[model samples]
Target: MQSIEKYPHYFNSIKEVHENIQSIIPEIAGAYKNKYNLSFPVDINLIVGGFGSNAYTYRQIIPNITFALEKLSPNPDHLRVIVAHEFGHLAQYIMLDDAGMDWSKSRWTHPLIWLYREGIATHLSRQIADNIHPSVYFSYNDEGVQWLTFAQANMIRIKQAFMEDFKALTSEKLFHEWFSINGGNRFGYSRLAYFLGNRFVLEYMEKHGEQATIIAWREENFEAKIAQWLSQEGVDKSE
Candidate 1:
């Protein structure tokens, strides 16, 4: 893909971002290698005009790896986190393969998959970025500022609940459901999905290694397994 000099002027130049993203790969791989003990190819693409100004994994038959950025040099700390997060996904994907996941036939809605995909990156990204909140960030502000208002509220709740407890926020069934419900374009829902998935996996990491977590995430019935996570878990549902 031709490099679109479209790196938002509010951030760094495309060339700068390209260098940063490229240079971080070895450090990223090394971090996970020591933590999870696995290796995977990391090929990222710089794509703007995406639904999110975040990094994500591109799934293909061969999984041509990708990690997108909303802006070239969005807050340096955030950029570092996003890159590390996407790289985390690459690492987890390799772990999933080692565990014999049947990705080609998988439905992709598995909640555990959400956690594995979003959480590992989240956990690692926070570290690389030296972030205070391991899985959350704030954008805008104000009530009429719909996105900021909601995110701020969610952040408060997350810190009170998930940040401390973690298990209370972990759920496979509701993860994808929230993804669809909050994702149309109307704001905070989709972003909330990212943090939810991450928090769940960060907790999972404590109990399971990367490979085991990936396999569990890819399991066909995790959504069903996590069916009652919301109503019974006791995290404010008033969002």
Candidate 2:
């Protein structure tokens, strides 16, 4: 309420966002369907104010994507990447559910789980969206200039700190420092974990192949494998 009141222009593009987002949803979803040969019903909902994310996926008997128009970038390329990223999440969840993944037992609280989730989605966004500037795939907008530069330069340091946090920090602290928008105490940039996740997906795909890496969530030793990957040195150099 306060944000809307003070920064009315923040949501001034709501109408435009609504039109463009509705127009692109099917196109991007179709590309994903064709790429993976997996088609599933998805409900795309647009809202004025959401949980502060530009977009996210939620499943309640069916998969749905919610776009907070105010948080979104109206640039067509950014919209495609963001939408495709959310659908990438849908593809991941559907694959796991089809494999009989017990949602109750899944390690939802683990940071590495999130790393894989965001990593694969970011990877899929890069593939699904038409050729755009590379940083758009990660940050989904032009505003990511600083974030991209920092992530590229400090990849190894970030991984080391992330691994240390995995062993030392609680889930809440880990997420805040790495994943949340308000994070970045160490590196002065939030959501650096997305960069980490992308690297994980890339390396894992190189080692195990794309199909296996996509469904690695179902593997019995997922945690151990991710831990081992994290413990290794110079994984950044591979990229």
Query: Model 2: how far is 24 from its true place, Å?
Result: 0.7
Q: Give the TM-score of candidate 2.
A: 0.92
Q: What are the per-residue Cα lDDT tens digits for candidate 2 across 1-239?
A: 67557446665567677778887888887898788876768667888774377787774424788898888888888999998898888888877777777677678667898998899999888889968887888778898887888888888898889999878999999999999888889888999989988888898898899878888887775978777777776735422
Candidate 1 Cα misplacement greater than 4 A, ranges: 1-12, 47-54, 67-70, 109-116, 127-190, 202-211, 218-220, 235-239
Q: What's the lDDT for all of these models?
A: 0.50, 0.82
Q: Which residue pairs in model 1 clash with each other?
A: 119-198
Q: Which candidate gets the maximum lDDT versus the true structure?
A: 2
Question: What lDDT score is found at residue 16 in candidate 1?
Answer: 59
lDDT of 1 by residue, 1-239 (tens): 23334334424454555666666666666766776676665455665544344444556423555555443343345455555666666665666677777877665644435544565556556554553442233221112245434644564454333223334434543443344433424333444555555545544555876446555756766654433342133433221
